[model samples]
Structures are given as C-alpha cells and as structure tokens.
Target: MIALVDMNSYFASIEQLDRPEWRGRPLGVTNGRTGTCIITASYEARACGIRTGMRVREARALAPDFIQVPARPYRYAQVSSSIMAALESITPDIEIFSVDEAFLDLTACQKLYRCPVEVVARKIKHCVFEASGLLCSVGVSGDKTTAKWAAKQQKPNGLTIVEPWRVAERLAPVPVTELCGISTGIGRFLAQHGVYLCGDMKQIPISVLAGRFGNLGRRIWLMAQGLDPEPLHREVKAPKTIGHGKVMPPDTRDRQEVDRYLMHMCEKVATRLRRHQLQAGVFSIGLNTRRGWVARKLKTVHPTADSDPLIALARFFLENWWDGVGVHQVHVAALDPHPQACQGELFAPDHARRDRVLAVMDAVNQRYGEFALCRAPLVKRSDMPNVIAPSWKPAGYRNTLEP
Candidate 1:
C-alpha cells in the first residue's frame, strides 16, 4: 500500500505553532510586502475566505482583522526535517514530493506494525504531531496517484483510505483537476470533450486519448480508473532547474532596482548550483510585467556555476525584453546541467582566474554570510527577499540539523 501525507497549511501552520498569539487566529504568511500574495493561510483565515496566492490587499478586503506574518523558510525547513525523520522511522521507502508532502510504501510499514492500515496511519500522524506539533492528512491506497488524491479529501487532520475495491466509488465524483498532472488547461481540454469527473474518464477510448496526449493520455486514463502502476520512487529526483523570484512592490519599474534584484537572485541560484556540485549549461531570466510575463533563455557553450556571467546574461536579456512594461517581478534560473568539462580559450586566461576568484568568494561567504563579497550593485541591498522555492532543501540551510 502507498501512504501519501500532506501537511496542513504548512507555512501558516508553522507560524501559528511557533507563536502562541497566532494560534487559532485568522493569520497568513507572506513574503513581507503588502502587494505580494499570501504564500499560505491558516485554517481560521481560510474560513474567512483567505487563500494562498491571494494578494494581501484582497485578503484584507475580505477580512479586515486578518493578521499577516512574514515567511521564515529556515524555520519551516527545520520543522519539515523533523517530520521527515519521524516518517523515516516508519519506513525507509519515503518519497518527499515537496516540503509539505511525502509518500511512503506502507506495505512494509504495515507488516512491521502488524496492525490495521488505519491504525498504522494514525500512528504516523501521532508521530508527526509529537515531533513538530503539526497536523497532516494521510491517504492510503494501492497506488500513488489514488493515495495522493485521497489525502486531499480531508483538511487540517484527516485520514482517508481508498481500498482497492472502493477506488472508483470514492474518486469518481471528484473533479478531473484533482488528479495528478491535470492542469487547469488540461482539465478544460478534458471537460470540453465530456470528461469532467474522475468516473467520466473511463468512457474515453485509450486510443483516442493517446492520439490527443500521447503517453500522458494513457496515464490520465489509468488515473481515472483509480489505478497508478507507477511505483513509489525510492530516490528523490534531482531538480531539472533551480530558480527564485520575488514579487516587486506595486507600480515600481525602475530598471536599476530590477537589476539589483536580478543580480541578487543570480547570486542565490549560483550558490545553490555550486552547493549541489552542479553546473548549468542554460540560463534564463524572467520578468513579470503589468501586461504579461516574458522569459529569455540562452544556452552557453561552456558549463559554469559562476554568478557574474549569469548576472551579466540576465541583464542582457532584461534590457532587450523590457518594452517599457511596468515590471512587477524578477526571476533567474539555472537549467539543464552540463555534463561536459569546462571549456577554456587560450587567449582568455582570465577565465580560470575568474573561476578561482568566484570559488574564493563563495568560501568567504560560506564562512561569513551570503552576499558578503557580493557585487557592487548588491552591496547596499538589504531588501533582497530571502524566499525559498518549492525545490528548496533543508540541507541548503546554513545550520541544518538534518541527519
């Protein structure tokens, strides 16, 4: 059996757990800007119609007495690490889907416990609560997709089981969007073709679905049948790309200020790449504007993990892409890890010298602090957002206690 566990309003729940006054209050966690969206909302805030990705102004308009707190990625990660450790005690077969969600191969754990699946599920929840003072919803099924879908049926603290026989009955009425890999666009496409509910999918011919979506169509069909042949991945897949972005204060479009944020983000991305012992062959810079968003990507002949080159590329892309649009955010990403060795030109001996300089800079910053030896543009920038991407690992934290 597979057990999928999801934390309840993770960031806001952590904020409430750490602060006594915030508990049971209508609160939200955000990125420290009034214009930015709330990253997570507590159950109390949800009761007041507050939700994740809702702008602070909109949330305030909905609930005048809403309390907002800045997100602490470090604290959230520390608690996540503890919860994962507790899960590890139950079974070694744990796949961390994200910071707030994980799946376990409960087949082994069930045998070890020699108890009913419901009892084992309850023990897992109690273990997590004892470790981190947080609640998690767990769903158990024979398949990963069904387990995950079942986990979301309840909130705050819930345990739902989809036994092999009841999979279709339990999931049939649910919207197609609730299944994994079903985006809003995909859901719309499916809905237009009369596949709205999970049960409705079995009516579509596999060949027709395959003609439209290839392998993804077949996967969707299987999920609709409440079966997922995909096994629990014992190893966590390495991220294909590493990136970070910050929502700018409303109505601000100064190019120089955007450059500052871009440079800071590049530094962060490079630091993460080097920490993972990875080098990127492609880099991308994105700007979210009032009109729309634009991203420009470039592939390098040589793999590099240095921040200076990335920052320069980002600046180049931004200057060309910006068309007097009111920019609202800055994002930078390192994608497609290069497998080739570093290529150097004979004339540019400074290439190796620059790499050494960056290595030394990284060393100094690792000892002192992030951006301690940052470039000139970022020296006085204290407003640089310290946000964590979904791909963030607790091991990336400076003082992580993870084993």
Candidate 2:
C-alpha cells in the first residue's frame, strides 16, 4: 500500500501552534513583504472566504479581524524535519513530497506491524502530531496518485482508504481536477469531452487521450481508473535550475530600487548554487512590467556561483532589456549547473581566495541567519524574500529553509 500524509493549513497551522492564543482564530500567513499576498489561510479564515493568493486588503474586507502572520521558513523547516523523522521510524521506503507532505510505501513493512494499513495510518497521524503538535490527513491506496487523491477527500485531520477493488466505485464521484496531475485546463478539456468525473473518464478511449495530451494522456487515463503506475520517488534529484523572484511593491520602478531587489535575488540564487556545490553555466533574468514579461538568457564562458558575477549579469539584462516602465516583479535564475569541482579557476590563487571568502560568508549566514552578513546594497534592506518554495524538503539540497 501507498500512503500520503498531508499537513493541513501548514504555514498558518504552524503559526497557531507557536502562538497558542491564535488557536481557532482566523489567521493568514503572508510572504513577509509589503503588498504580499496570502500564502496560506487557516481553516477559520477559509470559513470566512479568505484563501491563498488573496491580497491582505481582500482578506481584511472579508474579515476585518483576520489575523495576519508573517511566515517563518526556518521555524516551519524545523517542525518539518521533526515530523519527517517520525515518519522515517515507520518505514524507510518513503518519499519526502514537500515540506508538509510525504509518501510511504508499506508493501514490505505492513506485515512487520501485524496490522491493517488503516491502523498504520492512524499510527502515522499520532506520530506526526506528537512530533510537531499539528494535524495532517492521510490517504492510503495502491498507488501514489490514488493515495494523494484519497488524502484530500477530507481536510484538517482526515483518514481515507481505498482498497484496490474499491478504487473505481469510491472515486466515481471525485472530479477529474481533484487528481494530483490534473489542472483546471485539463479538467476543462476533459469536461468538454463529457468526462467530468473519475468514473466518466473511463468512457474515454486511451488512444484519444494520448492523441490529445500525448504521453501525459495515458497517465491521466490510468489515474482515472485508480491504476496509476507511477512509483514513489524515494531519491532526491538535483534541481534543474535554482532561482528566486519577488513581486515588487506597487509602483516600484526606480532604477536603484530595482537594482537592490535584483542584487538580492542574485545573491539568493548564488547562495543556493554554492549550497549544492554547483556553478551555473547559464544565467537568466526576467522582469514583469506594464507591457508583459521581458526576459534574457545568456551562456557564461565559465561556470560561476559567485554573487558578484550573477548581479553583474542581471544588471546587464536590466540595462538592455528593460523599458522605462513601472516594474511589477523581478526574477533571477541560475541554470545548466556543473559541479564546483569542474571549475578550473579554483586553481588560481585569487579565485581561491574569493571562494574562501564566499564560503565563510555562507557559513556565517547559515549559522546565524539569512543575510546576517550580506552585500553593502542589502545592508539596510528589510524586505528579503522569505517565501518557502513548495518543493522544500527536510534534507538534501532542497532544504533551503535551514537557517
């Protein structure tokens, strides 16, 4: 059996757990920047029609008393680590899906417990709560897709199971969009074809789905039949790209201000690359303006994971591509990474010294806090982006939230 454990209202729940008085009150967690949108909303806030992606103003209009809390990525990371450790005690064949979710393969360990999978699911819930003092929902099925679908059927603290034989009947009423891989676009397409529900999808031929969605269509068909063949990904793969972006405060178009934001983003991306002991062979920068997105990608003669070079490249992009329009957002990314060991410049004494300085800076920041020792431009800045990526995990390179 495959089981998925998903935390409820992750960021908001963590805030409420830390501040006991906030329990059962409407709360929303923001990205901790001016003009930031809601990242997560508590069940109480959801009851008041507040939701993720709603701006603070909209949330306030819905519930004036709705408490707003800034997200603490480090705190969330700590709790997630503890919860993941608790899960590791259950089975080693586990996939850390995200900071707040995981999948466990119980095919081998189920007999060890000498109990049904449902009992094991309950044990998981108890263990997670004991580890982090939070509630999570669990879904157990024969495959990862069905397990994820079953998990979301209920919220807050829910447990749902679907046996292999009952997958079709149990999922009949579930909408196609409720499945993990199906987006609203795909749901609409399926709906247009008269396949609105999981059961309805069965009426469609696999050949037609494949013709429309290509390879993804066959996978969708399997998901609808509750016979998804995708296996649990227990191994952590290296990220293809490392990047950071921020939504600028309203009317943020000044050159100096945009430079500061761009510098900060480059530094963040460089830090991540160095954390993974990799260097970017390509750099990409993007800006969202009144017209639309303006972006540039350039290949570097040599791979680098230094903030100065990244910042320089970003400035080049801004100087050449950006029109004098009001900027809405900015993004920086490092791509085509190669291991740091591949860089020949490490043999140069000057490059060696520079690398040492950057390593020390990274160590100090990791030990103390993010930006404890930052570049001069970021010295007085209070708006460092703190939004945690959805792919954050408790270990490996994806553990970017670690302080």
Candidate 3:
C-alpha cells in the first residue's frame, strides 16, 4: 500500500515548536513586512478563518488574539530533514513531493513494522513528531492517486485509511479540478460544460474525455477511477540535461546583474551534471526576449562542469546573439550523459583533480553549509540575493533539491 503523509501547519508549527508559549493559540507566520499577507497560519488560527496566503491584516482582523511570526525558510527545511530522516529509518521507499509532503511505499516495510497501514501511520507520525516537534496527517490507499486525495480528505493531523473497496465512494465527492495538473484554463473549460466534479466527469464517455484532453484527459479519467500507473518513487538515472532559470521581479534587466545570474545558474547546473559522475559535451544558453526566446547550443571539445569553460561558452553566446539587449530572462542548459550510459573517458591530469575538487567541496559543504566556500564572484556580489544564487553544490539538505 502507498501512504501520503502531510505536515500540519508547517511554517506556523515551527514557531510553536521553538517557542512553547505559542501552543494552542492562533499564530501565523507573516511576511517580514507588516501589512503583507500571512504566508502561513496555525490550525487554531485556521479555525477562525485564517489561512496561508491571506493578508495579515485580514487575519488579525479575523482574530485579534493571533500572534504574528516571521517565516524562516531554512528552519522549515531543517525540520523537513529531521522528519525525512525518521521516515528513512522506517522505510526507504519515500517520494518527497515538497518540504512537508511525501508518498511512501510501505509494502516491503509492513512485514517488519508488523502492523496494518493505520498502526504504521500512527507510529510514523509519532516518530516524526518526536523528532521535529510537528504533527503530520496520513492517508493510506492501494494506489498513488487515491493515496494523495485520501491524505487531503481531512487534514491538520487528521488520519484517513482507504482500502480498495472504499476508494470509489470516498473520491466521488471531490471536484475534477482538484487533480494535481489541471490548470485554471482547463478547469474553466470543463466547468463550462456539466463537469463540476470527477464523478460528474466520469459519467461522460471516455472517448469524449480523450478527444478533449488529448493524452492528459485519458490519464485524468484513469486517475478518477484510481488507476494511475505512476510509481511511489522512481530511481534516479543519469542526467539528461542541466539548466537553471530565475523569476526576477517583473521588468528589470541590468546586464551586470544578468551576468551574475548567468554565472550562478551555470555554477549550479554544471555542479549537478558532475555530481552524478557525468559531464556535458554541449552547452545551451537561453534568453527570454521581448517577443520570443533565443537558444543557442554547440558541442564542446570535452565534457565539463568547470566554471571557466562554461563562463567562456556563455560569453561567446552573449556576444553573438545577445547585444546586451531586450532579454527578459536567462537560462543555461547542458546536454549529455543519460547517467546510466555515461562512462568517464580518461583525460588530462586536470580531469582527476577537477573530480577530486568537486568531491572535497561536496564533503565540506555537507559539514559546514551551502555557499560556505562559494565562488568568489558569488560571495563578492552584493547586488544578488545570497540565497537565490546557490553554487554547483549538491544539497543533501531535506532530501529535496533546493532552488
């Protein structure tokens, strides 16, 4: 069976965990600036109509007793690590979806845990809470879709178990738009017809769903019937491509700033390529333009992740295609090595040292922290947000790749 585990009031719970005085009270983690929206709110505050992404003023007006707190992005990741480590100790079949959610395949673990899903979930919750001082709700089911939806059946430390027989009735009441990938555009189009919910959509012929949604409609129809083929987790394979992009504030472009961003993205993308014991033979630099996106790629003399070669390649593209012009955004993509198929070719003495340097840096970052020994340029730059520009450092933090 698969189980979806979700943390309760993640950001706000961290506050209560660190400061006991906030317990059982209406609390929220608002933006650093006052008058901004509350990014997260506690379960107690939720009862009084407070919720994440709601204005702090509105939340405070809703419940005057609510205490405000600032969001600590790192602390949430730390607590996530503490929880994921506990889960790994229990079972290795974990598919982490976000900081506070994971899908676990407990089939193999059941024999040793010596209980059904309910008991195992309870024990898991207990372990997580003890480790991180936060509560989690769990939903156990036979398939991935049902497991995910069942987890959302009730929340904030709620528990729901759905055996195969219960899946149909349990899911019939939920809306079709609730599926993970349905966009606002698709939902609106579906709503224009009589398809208000998944059950309603199912009553229509499958042919019609397929005709309308292409392949996605067929997948959605199967999901509604709890017949999704996605595994609880997929094994990591050799890297296909390495790339990074940024969501800068709407309309601002300074070439110097773009250069810094390009360097930073290259550092990260190249690091990931090398981390999997592979390298790239070709590099692509992309820029979003006033009217279109421009991408230029070329095969290199050798596979590489070193910053100097990557920077030179990027500069070449910038000089040719980019005139320090109306580029709205920057992206760097490197293509090579489906890791399973890649074999390292013996090269110069530098190849061995470059690999060793990456290893030593990885170990150091693991012990100290990210950007602890960063590229001198990243460290020197005061214009870019420090956390936004991470290096070619593979993060073992929280079991999720940090952005």
Candidate 4:
C-alpha cells in the first residue's frame, strides 16, 4: 500500500503552534512583514473567506480582525525535520514530496506493524503530532495517486483509507481536478470531453488521451483507475537549477536599491551551489517590469560557484537588457551544474584569496545563521520575503537557507 501525509495549512498551522495567542484566531501568514499576498490562512481565517493568494487588503476586508504573521522559514524547517525523522522510524521506503508532504510505501512494512493500515495511519498522525505538535491528514490506498487524493478528502486532522475494491466507487463522483496533476485547464478539457469525474474518464479511449496530452494522458487514465505505476522515489534527485527571485516593492525602482537586491540574490544562489559542492557553467538573470519580462543568459568560460562572478554577470545582464523600466521583480539562476572541480586561475592569487574568504564566510554563516556574515551592502536591507519554494525538502540540496 501507498500512503501520503499532508500537513494542513502548513505555514499558518506552524505559526499557530509556535504562538499560543494565535491559536483559535483568524490568522494569515504572509511571505514577509510587508508582503501584500497571503501565503496561507488558518482554518479560522479560511472560515471567514480568507485564503492563500488573497491580498492582505482583501483578507482584511473579509475579516477586520484578521491577524497577519510573517513566515519564519527556519522555524518551519526545524519542525519539518523533526516530523520527517519521526516518519523515517516507520519505514525507510519514503519519498519527501515537499517540505509539507511525503509518501510512504507501506506494503513492505505491513508485517512489521501487524496492524490494520488504518491503525498505521493513526500512528503516523500521532507520531507527527508528537514530533512537532502539528496535525496532518493521511490517505492510504493501493497506489500513490489514490492515496494522495484520499489524503485531501478530510481537513485539519483526518485519516482516510481506500481499500482496493472501493477505489472506483469512492473516486467515481470526485472531480478530475481533484487529482494531483490535473490542473483546471486539463479539468476543463476533460469536462468538454465528458470526462468530468474519475468514473466518467472510462468513456475516453487511452489513444485519444495520449493524442491530446501526450504521455500525461495515459497517466491520467491510470490515475482515474486508482492505479499508479509510479514508485516512491527513495533517492533524492539532483536539482537541475539553483535560483532565487524576489518581488520588488510596488512602484519602487531606485537603481542602487535594485542592485542591492540583485547582489543579495546572486549571493544566495552562489551559497546554495557551494553548499551542494556544485558549480554552474551557465548563468541567467531576469527582470519583470511594467513592460514585461526581460532576461538574458550567459555561458561562462568555466564552471563556478563563487558569488563575485555571479554578481558581476548579473549586473552585466541587467545593464545590457534592462531599459530602466519600472521593475517589479529580479531573478538570478545558476544552471547546468556539475560537481565542483574547477581548476583555479594559475596567475590570479587574488582569486585564490577570495575563495578562502568565501569559505570562511560560509562556515560562519552556517554555524550562526543565514546572512549572519553577509556582504556589506546587505547590512541595512530589510529581510527578504520568507516565501518557501514548492520544491523545498527537509534535507538535501533543496533544503534552503533558513531565515
């Protein structure tokens, strides 16, 4: 059997757990203190029609007393690590789906537990709560897709199980959009083809689905049948790209201020590359402006994981591409990473010294906290938005810097 564990209103729930006063109150967690968008809303806030992605003004309009809490990525990471450790005790066959979700292959461990799958699900909930004092919903079924679907059937603290025989019956009335990979666009397309529900998908031929969605259509058909051939990825996949981006404060475009933020982002990307002991052969920078996105990419002479070169490249890209338009966002990305094995500059002693300095800085920051030892320019800058990427994990390269 496969099981999925999903945290409910993850960021908001963590906020409430850490702050007793915030419990039982309508609250929304924002990306930063000044962030306009709601990252997540507590059940109380949701009850008042507040939701993730709603602007702070909209949330306030819905609930005048709605409390806004800035996200603490470090705190969330710590809690997630503890919860994942608890899960590891259950079975080694597990996939860390995201910072807030995971999938476990329970088939092999069933004999060890010697209990009903439902009992095991309850134990998982109890273990997670004991580890982090947070509630999570669990779904168990014969496959991963069905289990994920079942997990969402209940909210807050819930455990739902779909026996093999009941998969079709239970999923028959559920909308196609409720499945993991089916977005609203795909759902609408399916609806047009009279495949609105899992059961309704039975009418469409696999060939037609394949023709429309390519490989994904066959996967959708299997998901509707509650059969997922996809196996749990016990191994962590190497990240294809390391990047960071930040939204510029509304209507603010001082060149010096933008450069400071850009430098900060490049430093972050470089830190991540070094943390993973990787080097990027390609660099890219982008700006989202009122005129739309302007981006450029450069292939470096050699792979590097150093911040100075990255910052320089970013500035070069911006200088060449940006037309001094009203900027809304800045992005920095390091691509085509390979294991760090760069041959140092033979004649450039300054490059060697700089590398040593960066190593020391990294060590100090890792021991203390993120940005505890940062570039001089970032000293007075306000905190970056505490938005966690959807690809965030409890461990490995994707385990981002804490704030």
Whose TM-score is greatest here?
4
lDDT (10s digit) by residue, model 1, range 89-138: 88889887778888898776665688888998898899889989999999
Model 4 regions lying over 4 Å from their true place = 342-350, 401-403
Over 66-115, each residue of candidate 3 has an lDDT whose tens digit, in order, gives: 88886666667677767877887768898777778888888888789787
Query: If ranked by lDDT, best first, what sequence of candidates would result?
Result: 2, 4, 1, 3
lDDT of candidate model 3 versus the reference:
0.72
The per-residue C-alpha lDDT of model 4 at residue 255 equals 80
TM-score of predicted structure 1: 0.86
Each candidate's clash count: 0, 0, 1, 0
For candidate 2, give the lDDT of residue 263.
Answer: 88
User: Candidates ranked by TM-score, best first?
Assistant: 4, 2, 1, 3
Question: Highest lDDT: which candidate?
Answer: 2
- lDDT of every predicted structure (CA atoms): 0.79, 0.86, 0.72, 0.85
lDDT at position 135, candidate 3: 82
Candidate 2 lDDT over residue span 103-158, tens digit each: 99998987799997789999999999999999999999999999998888888799
Model 2 weakest lDDT span, ten residues long: 341-350
Regions more than 4 Å wrong, model 2: 33-36, 342-349, 382-384, 401-403
TM-scores for the candidates: 0.86, 0.94, 0.77, 0.95
Local error of candidate 4 at residue 272 (angstroms): 1.2
| Candidate 4 per-residue lDDT over residues 119-235, each given as its tens digit | 899999998999999999999999999999999888879899999888989899988888999999889889888998899988989888899998888889889988767889877
The C-alpha RMSD in Å for every predicted model, in order, reads 3.8, 2.2, 4.7, 1.9
TM-score of 4: 0.95
